[model samples]
Target: MINNLFSAVSAAAAQEHFDELLRRPGLRIERIVSQGQASPTGFWYDQPQGEWVVLLSGSAGLRLAHEPSERVLSPGDFVEIPAHCRHRVEWTDTSAPTVWLAVHFDAV
Candidate 1:
């Protein structure tokens, strides 16, 4: 089946939307749509899998534990986060939905 990444977007959203595009052993792909969402204060993500993610549209702020400042991501911006790297989503565009493509994979 053919699919479009920008499809299935809702103009009125109260929370972030997560769509799983593909999944297999040790790997997962997802499309995330965010509107004015951020990780709760004092909370962080520590995962056992590495993640490669890209900002497909809108904008966002990402903070990593080893980084001194948050990294601002615009459309097309991408990053590779290693396993066990504590990270958080600091901010996302509120006026428009922020789209993201993320690939998570366990170390080989």
Candidate 2:
């Protein structure tokens, strides 16, 4: 039995990405801690593996690719990203801290 779990601990609470988070075979996990700011303009995430994003604080807006609508997220909100679905972070809380927990894994 594995009794230990590796946790991603962030020292600063601000907007960031997973570019330097971690890497392993078929899996990646990231902790995003943010405060006040919309996502980068017109930038989207194209993932090869299915992704799951959970909001731990504040709020956000997600615009899915090819979709004409945007979804709102707040504390305790969780979303699943299917492989190959292009998506973008439209906006986020501009007055408070927003934290996110992202989990990635390959489909079997």
lDDT of 2 by residue, 1-108 (tens): 442122443434454544335668988977675655565787788888898899987788888987899899988899999988889888777676567878898966
* TM-scores for every candidate against the unseen true structure: 0.97, 0.74
The parts of candidate 2 lying over 4 Å away from their true place are: 1-24
Cα lDDT of candidate 1 equals 0.95
Q: After superposition, how far is residue 25 of candidate 1 from its true place, in Å?
A: 0.9
Predictions in order: lDDT: 0.95, 0.74
- Give candidate 2's root-mean-square deviation (CA, Å): 4.2
Tell how far residue 7 is off in model 1, in angstroms.
Answer: 0.4
- Window of ten residues with lowest summed lDDT in model 2: 2-11
What is the C-alpha lDDT profile of model 1 across 3-70, one tens digit per residue? 99999887648889999999999999999999899999999999999999999998999999999999
Best by TM-score: 1
